[model samples]
Target: MKGGTKKIELYDTTLRDGTQGEHINLSVQDKLLIAGRLDEFGMDCIEGGWPSSNPKDEEFFKRAMDLELRHARLAAFGSTARYSDRIETDPNLLGLVGCGAPVITIFGKTWQAHSKTGLGISDEENRALIKNSVAFLRNAGREVFFDAEHFFDGWKDNREFALDMLKAAEEGGASRLVLCDTNGGSLPHEITAIIEDVRQHTDIAIGIHCHNDGDLAVANSIAAVMAGAIHVQGTVNGIGERCGNANIISIIANLVLKLPETGASVRDLTQLTSLSNFVFEILNLPPDSKAPYVGRSAFAHKGGIHVSAVMKESSLYEHIDPALVGNRQRVLVSELAGQSNIRYKAQELGISIPEGGEQIRKIVNHVKDLEHRGYQFDGAEASFELILQKELGTFTPYFEVIESKVYVESGIGGRNVDQAVLKVRVGEEIEHIAAEGDGPVNALDKALRKALIRFYPEIKGIKLVDYKVRVLEEKRGTSARVRVLIETGNGRTTWGTVGVSTNIIEASLRALEDSMNYHLFTLKATEPKPAAEENH
Candidate 1:
């Protein structure tokens, strides 16, 4: 490859470092799933996990070795051998090599404080441990990556000693020398200078490992790359010790979308958002909407002026086209709505605002009033679309609002008398479904789905994926209002809808109704036409 044409390698350690985050644990199967997805996303290396630390990681590395990875090399990670131990007899080194990974990463102390205090060893002994561990892995026919733990703080305290450690790893045949910001306190300028100084001393490939304690992991990692680092090491979703590691999702999205002139083509930048969501979903964690590039609100505009400008030309407010990172621009409807905002929102819902001069003003005023009373249409797009449908008289009921009744009977004696029954009518059909669950909400969801399945068999496949309930404080004493957000999903797609009322059950029901209606509405809109149109 030409000098400027070389692609920076993305080395993802999510499975290893990410699992270290509190309350986040991945099973062996989960690790494999993540590894597969990362490989599919074109990551250069998937640091499967530290085999020496856990059986699950050992199993993952062993199983990963048998699988055919197209774009990712499976790497096993571990720390260097104990200070007094020989490399030949070190169990950590033996386990890492035995795990069957073609690549192994070993971390060692570079900070003088850690060498003397944490490891209780002299500086010379720490350097020897780093060199011997790297040499052992390299001699085992495995590519070795040496992580100079706390290299940033180490360089700040003892620059000469830190550079000496890098030299030791290089002489031991380590493939790459990774400078880690273990404390995550280094700024971009500091990183740039350190990388530049290291480049002047060594010809070895340089890499960066960063943490997000200061929320600058991504910035510092990018700075290191700009300063001549070839590999960027981070975890997905920025999950790691302390705040987290550099977010590979954000880094990749920024590099691919904002720096296209750098001679690197990330042709699949469109997959970035979905991939980020996928990893978060697998971890069963809520995604941060404000995360750069791939977040939900990254392209959302709610301010009147901003929305108007964005509606006119998205580039006016958007830093980069959201579509480049698998996202789309979202014009949010809020209290700050102008006439342009109202018109654009209406247009998005396929609702044509009559050319009358007063129509836009009326809609904008109504939107503002509703928002002032605690209606957040921006986060509830499905409900907003429903509003547009009603305004345009474009919404027809998918099924008649059949009377729904629920009954419950509890056992008084030894006889089994406890029972809950639900009945509903849709169009000409009357359906009765009953179920017992831990709560009324659970029972209601089951009964509703059962009844809807009679008229729409597709309802059987739809599931409530997420449900959130918030108590509105206006009616604090006797009739406190509640807002419910219900996220429903078929196997292929998901939609979110919100409902508000004094009664929590009533709010949940309304949201559930909207969820089903939105699914049916979108389904019909996207359905294929007749054979004649298809042929044409």
Candidate 2:
């Protein structure tokens, strides 16, 4: 197992902490899959959920016992023993010892207010719980991590009492003392001050854990590291309850790329992006495209000036080589695009266009005009490619639509059905087809495919995965021009096409037509065929 510098240890709680986010849910199998991936990504530790909480967590720990992890050691999480007569019979403590994990992390209330009101315990009793819990878990042959919940707020409220909790845990043989920003309200300066002060008085190694309610979790974590922290704990993509935990994604990039002297680095830094998206994919949630280092748009260049600069000297616009983190630079086309945009996009899409020619100006002007009329070519590159083919006089209509009609009707049993009737011509033969579907778009898609499948059998493989419509002018209400974007995929690949019109159905048909046309172009491009006959 390859590990990061011993100066700083990486602990991930995504399986436990990440699942607390609003839409984040994972099965036991899902957690196990992520654990293996994290180990492969070179994580130092993976926190399995508190086994005492539910049966799912217990099952997760049981199943995780055979993970065959290469790098990360699995840890179990729980709070210290509840204030009870006998610590030996504590269920939470017992669950921690027998969770089949080598490491155990137990959070105890350090804030005097929480200890008094939340736990209904005195200061001395709370200290006893924290100390005794660590001792009990250590005696069970498990390495103990003591998380001081609300540590910063506790220090600010009563500096001496907070210091006593650390002493209590250390006296009981805690291996690592983690200071947590439970409410996530501490600023960077406060974190620096508190962690430094705590460092001087504590004997155990200090770790940092932060929440994102104040939106400074990452900032505060870095601040804590500079102060004295030697361990960092967070969830991937910052998924957690409320705002979130500190984003381990951003933290890892900063630590490895910017603070390597701190001995924090990953095994393969290039796999960072795949890891970020993998977690989102497993949880079935959309990734935040603007996220640093790993997001789709992180290195995408849009403005004409920026693209021009990036083309000449990539360092002028890009902060770092996108390939360093498994991302690439993309030049976007929009109404704001210049001739440079057209030239760059042509080469990027593998379409040929002469540079500094009248054809380039015409294409640029046409793009501006179309974008002014509610066409967004930036997101629909397949639609833009069709425009390029048309300008070059190399595009041919695979199937021409002669006429189309669509309508929705209610059934006898309160069922609603939409139907589309399409008259399409492939070569000299005409196909008139009608298909019923759940909605207007689906009906159109089905009817169009049925009309063309006889000639292009490959049309059966295309599936409409996404369809979205945007109103250009909300004030015009039903009279407003609408823009439609459709996404099509064939298991192996996906492409987007776009359309615009005041009539929603007309706009949909335009996007659908573009999608089918682009699919045919791709099919012909990859398959061996006579060159001149394809252009017809």
Which has the greatest lDDT? 2
Which residues of candidate 2, in runs, are more than 4 Å off? 1-6, 529-536
Return the TM-score for each candidate structure.
0.85, 0.96
Residues 24-63, model 2: lDDT tens digits? 8999999999999999999999998999999999999999
For model 2, give the 10-residue run with minimal summed lDDT: 1-10
* For every candidate, C-alpha RMSD to the true structure in Å: 4.2, 2.9
In order, candidate lDDTs are: 0.82, 0.90
Q: TM-score for model 1?
A: 0.85
lDDT of 1 by residue, 134-175 (tens): 998999999999898999999999999899989989988998
